[model samples]
Target: MTRRTPSTSHRRHQRGVSLFGLLFWAIVVGFFGYLAVVVFPTVNEYFTIKRAVDKIAAEAPATVPEVRAAFERQRAIEYSISSIGSNDLEITKENDRLVIGFAYEKEIPIVGPVYLLLKYEGRSGQ
Candidate 1:
């Protein structure tokens, strides 16, 4: 049996990505990263609002107005909330428990004249 050495062509066929390919992937990753940075805050804010509402629901207020007032108080203390208000809530009663529901939209500007509208909804009872 004869043993043959590997050809130079085989060695020349290098592995891994090219500079351009690397740059392209970097840009793609960077874009999604920036998108996450922009979008995450909105989602986080929605969750914060949801948590506050849940707290109010857990307290089990006596009436719809009282529910709104409780939320208003929470919002006053929690400076992170700016998009929601008492009027925005959908108050109802279920199983003799106060349920506070709300739906709102957040407009996030990604670039010039381009915005992302995030719609968020939650119920305090759930």
Candidate 2:
């Protein structure tokens, strides 16, 4: 029968995460997860707004008011686009093509006195 004791070299060469290291990584991952959970909805809304704008632009509304109204109607339907109002849309005609653009800021609170500010802007495809 042979009994083997852990050598100093083996102990020093051990590679693994300590409890503290694991905890630190867990906290970091958890924090990013929390941020993603908080930010995803706003990002979804941004995409929704972009889609609505693209649709409106493609439809080629006659007037700026018409574009704005179309966006309002879309907002009423989507319910996710609450960050910007119809008036916030920038309507312009580039080469006689209706281009709708918008920009808005979203503030997300992560913790006490800590907030994340996201600026979103997009223009409809011609």
Candidate 3:
């Protein structure tokens, strides 16, 4: 058997890994980073709205109209709060205070479906 020497060009070609691999991992990290920074906050807002709604009837004045008005105020607050960021959220009265809910739409990082929806509801205490 004859001993063969490796060419310098071959060594250079095999050095490290492909740039494509690095790029692929970069994209994945970017996506997850976006989820952590952006998506998580929107999700938090959904729960926040839910928590706020759950307390509305208890915290609001003891009247149907008062509850309704409080929900409307919540809607306004949702819009105002979301406007400060990339997350776009909306609140609508479904049926009295028993079915009030919120929906959100966001432009996800490198993802489609530019909208996300979330709902919450509560009933008046008798």
TM-score of predicted model 2? 0.90
For model 2, the stretches where C-alpha displacement exceeds 4 angstroms are 1-12
* Lowest lDDT 10-residue stretch of candidate 3: 83-92
Report the lDDT tens digits of candidate 3 across residue range 13-85: 4566588989999988987787677667666665656655566744735555665566567767676334222
Question: Which runs in model 1 stand beyond 4 Å of their true positions?
Answer: 1-12
Ranking by lDDT: 2, 1, 3
Ranking by TM-score: 2, 1, 3
Clashing pairs in 2: none
TM-score of each: 0.86, 0.90, 0.46
RMSD of 1: 2.8
lDDT of 1 by residue, 37-122 (tens): 99887888888899999999899888878888998999998888888998899988878777889999989887899998888999
Model 1: lowest-lDDT 10 consecutive positions: 2-11
lDDT of each: 0.87, 0.91, 0.52
Model 3 TM-score, 2 decimals: 0.46
